[model samples]
Target chain A: MIIEGRTWLFGDKIDTDVLAPGYAMKLSPEGLAQHCLEAVDPDFAKLVKPGDIVVAGANFGLGSSREQAAISLATLGVGAVLAKSFARIFYRNAINIGLPVVAIDLTQEVAPGDILKLDLAAGTLTRLKDGYHRELQPMPPHIIDILEAGGLMAQLKQKRGL
Target chain B: MPQTLTQKIIARACGRTTVKPGEIVTVNVDLLMGQDASGPRRWRPRLEELNAKLWDPSKVVVVSDHYVPAVDAQSAEILNISRRFARDYGVKNFFDMQGISHAIMPERGLLRPGMFVAGGDSHTPTAGAFGCYAAGFGATDTTAIAITGETWTTVPETIKVQIDGALGPEITAKDVMLWLCREMGMENSFKSVEFMGSTVSAMSMSERLVMSNMAAELGAEAGIIGVDEITIEALKATGGDYEGAEAWVADPDAHYYKTVTLDVTKLGPQVAAPHAPENTDDVGAFAAVKVDQCYIGACVGAKLEDLQMAASVLRGHRVSPDTRLLVAPATVRVTEQAAADGTLATLTAAGAILLPSGCGACAGMGAGIIAEGEVCLSTTNRNFQGRMGHKDASVYLASPYTVAASAVTGHITDPRELRTSTRNAA
Candidate 1:
């Protein structure tokens, strides 16, 4: 999928509490989508458009591995996540739920609210306004296979010819 | 290539002889877990989205202790979701508000040595207490574990923390951890830490469990207390069939990326300052700091010993009118035992409000919230900015002794002074 959005840049260790506050933990996935980043920036939910990408530094999704962090971002219409590194659980959860996560070398060249374009299949990232190009390590064949199958359950179903 | 704990565990799970750092490999999971707050939301949706029939329902465990008995409608809703999810999935291992997920998992034999356990909560690394290469992952990772029972991970290098010397009075495992948090700060990111040496050997499993459980807050993948007789006894208490459980230890010549020594004798009661668990200072340095509230609960503080400590200081005393004291047990069983022992009576008579066994104030889900400019001395983890209540409110982290003393005095007072007060009363 070709995705484009204004990048929401965050520094290292953006834990689950910031992504999905404990107070709102009771809300449905759709409800959580509306409150994403309410702790860090109140207007983040309203400001984000569909197909937008969130770029964060190392240890993104660092604290509690609640998949809600990924599901909330996904249901909020986050097109992709680009980070320097991801906590193991968050990374797996994002991909399993059909959210594309790319680990790219973060540089000072990108700033918050910078419009960027990502081609998941091509493994290419481009800052739309600045014309900056950065290539990311693409998902391997097996991971892409899992994604195309729409997660592990679907992959199993397909393998069984169901 | 040097083998790390992550490498060794992943390799065995993947059926490989060896794996290197930064190399990705998808390995099978021996156990999967989720707590009340995160499980229902993530697992139910993923289960539906995938449309897969539940595998062995017993392999999955749902715990509802974060806000058991429901703190508010939100917490209540989450609890309902967890119960409904567990029932529908036929999950026989649902721990309904029984206790902290980590504390209960071992008690139920869900954690095994040399097994790969994944949980949706950060403290899942608590399984490492039993030599399981357990670690916490985000919800998405849990979805994978729930569905495929496997995940890809990069191996981490090991860091050895050697402990020696006996603890002095008032020194406890909690003090050892807070000291590490101060010494390591956030610089401890993404490493495996193992506790070894004579001092570690002398510690009880409960004490070691406390140390390993908080390792996540330090940014480490997992913390391990080397297996010993104490571990065997703990396993036995939990009905663990130790028929084939192998004992493993770090080799005398094993490699570590870093080595830090902790002399428990030198450590004192530590307090995490406002906004950061890592911003810890010795209690004597900040004894005069006042508080508006005092809370002792969460997995860290609800231990029976913790309550006894609080009760000893609070007996025949009253709480400060300005300072509210809330004590939540970690489990219903804990509440029952304390009530039977009259610890509950002493605490309630001292004006300490007894909340149910749930996460409560630790996660700021229910009572004990402070107003703007108010400060609270708490026995929970993470004093992160605005974590306890209003962003402007301050939270000071301390042990039950400090929290109880502060509750009675309306200001933070050392437990040593409480002893003096008791002497005067006699």
Candidate 2:
């Protein structure tokens, strides 16, 4: 599977509080998405287009186990996230919700709004702007299966014949 | 084969004699915990959609700490849904407004050593103080575990954190953790951190809980300390099973991805400035920073021992007229115990306003939250931006001792200075 999107840049330790602020947690998914990353980038939710890719520095989504942090981004139509690293729970949370998360340091190479293409099966990401390419370790088959089945909930529904 | 304590517990859960790191395996969960925000309020809809019932309600524990005494209609509805979920599912261990789930689980003897536990909140590793292989998961993963009674894990390589020597007076586990946040950094993902050494062994259950609790801040899968006499005795006192609990210790030759050691004899009280837990410095460095609020609350910092630490510092002193102090015990039991021991009296006499037993103000919810441009010195963990209130509010993380001392001075004062001055006067 291949994904293409414009890049949106963020910095190191972009914690869960920024991704889904605690004060806005009581809002609905759509409402919460409007406040996503509002602490750092007030225009993020409004300006972010569907199929946009978030490229961030290390330890992205570093605090809190709130799945809403990932949910807000997915709700805003973010196609995938590429960070230098991620907090373990957030990584799994994103995958469980059918959001693709990749680990690669592209903060220096890619500018905001630069279109990028991700080949999930091939484990390759190509910078459409400069034709620069980087390889990432392919996800395990079981994880891929879960992603293909549209996340863990969907996979579970399939197993139960729902 | 030698195995880390984490591996031993996971192997038991998976019905295997041994397991290796990096291998994915399905393990039966001994207990599953969740609180209002991440628990039933989110699970109910998905469970209904899947037409599923809880695999075993007896193994599930739910708490209403997050939205307790709901401040708004939305929060009230969330709490109501949590209550109805427990009733409909026949979840016997449901704890409504009983304080944080991390403190409630052990207080009720629901956790046992060697158990494979999953919680729906990040601080769930607090149970690792009892030697359980406890880790936090997202709502969806927790929902899956609720339905299946099992979950998959990619076994994590263990990072051994060894701290030797005694903590100086006024220095507590919170100080050690703040220092570790800087030493280890918050990027050790996909790893389990086991804290051990004379320092951890000598720590009370409350202090040990702090060490394991902050392992989340270190970005570890779980923060654990091997079961010892203190653990066994605490379990026995709490009416939990302690039989063979001491066998949960890690083998001496167990493989570790890395071992980080610290000698705490010379360590001073540490504090982390706002925006990140890893941004730590000695308490003295922040001495001139005045605070608007001094809060001692949350699952990690509002236990009986933590309350006692604050009370000791505030025994004959009053909170600064310039700064307000809020004290929220971790649970009803902690409050009862503190009240019985005069700890509550000492705190209140110091002009400390008592808050309800819940995750108040710590999760940027409920009461006592700061406003824009306000600053707070907090005993709770995690001072991430917008965590405890307005985005512009600055928070500094410190031990209860430091928080109480700072409350008296209206600035980030080291507890040692106050203790020394008090002793000199006495």
Candidate 3:
């Protein structure tokens, strides 16, 4: 699996409350994307375009089990979230929602708005601007299998012969 | 091979005799719960995709806890839809207006030792107090359970926490947890934490809930306490069958990567400073920090016992003129019992505003919204930026006792200083 997108850099432990505030708890998924990251970066929802990517320090997507944190990002058409590490549930939530999450060191390799190409099989990330490439942590077989089946729903449906 | 309680539960659910960390397996979920906001709204679409056949309705539960009194038309409609869906799907295990299911589920005997329960809400790991492996996931995973009654996981490594020494008369579980977060920095956010040693064995069932409820706040997958007398008593309280609960304890040689010890006797009332649960200091460390809101609720801090502790401190006193203190019981049932026991009356008399039972302000849903630049002292778990509504509003987390004492002074006052008026916790 390979994914390509422009980059958005964030700091460590960028929690869900900043990603999806409680005021939007009643809003639709699309409405949630509009307010996603509005707490930390007020222009996030309005500025994010589809196929953009999030790059962050360790412990990204921390706090809360709200799927909208991942939903809003995916809804805004984020290609992937490449972080040094991730919170347990947020990582699963992202994959279950069909959002690709890659563990990589994109901090020093690329700057804001730099395009990135991630190749899962080769375990490499290429910076289109500078052609600087780096190896990333490989996705385990189980995660890849689930992703291949198109998230949890598709996997369950396929397993159940639906 | 020896295994931790969480590992054993996962292995058993996977129908394997043994498993190790980093190995993946799909296991049938023991229980799955959701609320008005997270339940059917997301599941409806996935259910339609799966042709609407529920794998096992008995294992699934829908409850109306969020927006319980129907704050708006949308909330009211969501609650109605939850009831209708439970009826249409024959899911008999449903709750309405029960407050936080994180506390209600165990109190009602739905969670037990050795079970692997998944909830749509993030705080569901509170069930881990029963020696079960419980974690929170999104509604998409909850819907997957509806289809195949199973979810997948990579076994997480275990970290052992050895708590020793007797707690001070005024110190409580809340203090110990905040101290742990501060000292440990929430290590192993994707790992399991197993509590061992004398203090854990001596804690009451209610006390254990205080620990387990905050495990998620530490970013851990689950926190397990060895099943013992308190565990058995918890099971007996709800008339739950606990014939095999004793076996939930980890084997003698279970694998543990690290050990963090806490000497309760040496610890004092601690508070998590604003912006993060892991940011902590001695209660007196922030004596100059005044507060605008004082909250005692949420799954972690609002158990009946917690309410009793706060009421004991506020029995004949009033909150300071500048401070606003709020006491929210964890559930409707707790409300009735507290009222009968005078806990409610005491808090109300002390000018502690009693809010309805539900999870609101802890997640910034608005039962107690803070003004910009306002500071709050609370017993609720987590104090992230914007957690209590205003991003500029700060939150300080401490025990109900500390919060109650602070309510009277309108600043971060230590509970020990008011010893003449406060009752002994033990």
Q: What is the DockQ (computed on Cα atoms) for candidate 2?
A: 0.88
* DockQ of all candidate complexes: 0.39, 0.88, 0.71
**What is the Cα-based lDDT of residue B341 in candidate 1?**
97
Off by over 4 Å in 3: A160-162, B420-426
What tens digits encode model 1's per-residue C-alpha lDDT throughout B297-359?
Answer: 877777777788789888888998978898988777778879999989999999888887777
RMSD of 1: 3.3
Tens digit of lDDT per residue, candidate 3, span B1-426? Answer: 988888899999999978899788899898999887788777886798778667889888887777766778888888888888888888888888887888789878887788998889878878888998988888888887777788888888888999999998779989999988887785357788888888888888888888888888788989888788889888999877699889999998888877888788889899999798899999889999989989998888998999998988887778999999987788888999999998899999999898988886887874887879999999988988887888888999999999999999899888878765445532
TM-scores of chain B alone in all candidate structures, in the order given? 0.93, 0.99, 0.97
lDDT for B53 (candidate 3): 65
Q: What CAPRI-style quality would you assign to candidate 3?
A: medium
Q: Show where candidate 1 strays beyond 4 Å.
A: A102-107, A119-124, A133-162, B1-12, B16-20, B48-51, B71-81, B84-88, B187-190, B370-373, B417-426
Per-residue lDDT tens digits for candidate 1, residues A68-119, read: 7788898888888888777656676777777888887463668878889998
Q: Which candidate number would show the highest lDDT if scored against the true structure? A: 2
Predicted structure 2, TM vs. truth: 0.99
Estimate every model's Cα lDDT from 0 to 1.
0.76, 0.93, 0.85
The residue pairs in collision within model 1 are A65-B137, A65-B138, A65-B139, A66-B139, A67-B139, A67-B140, A89-B138, A93-B140, A93-B141
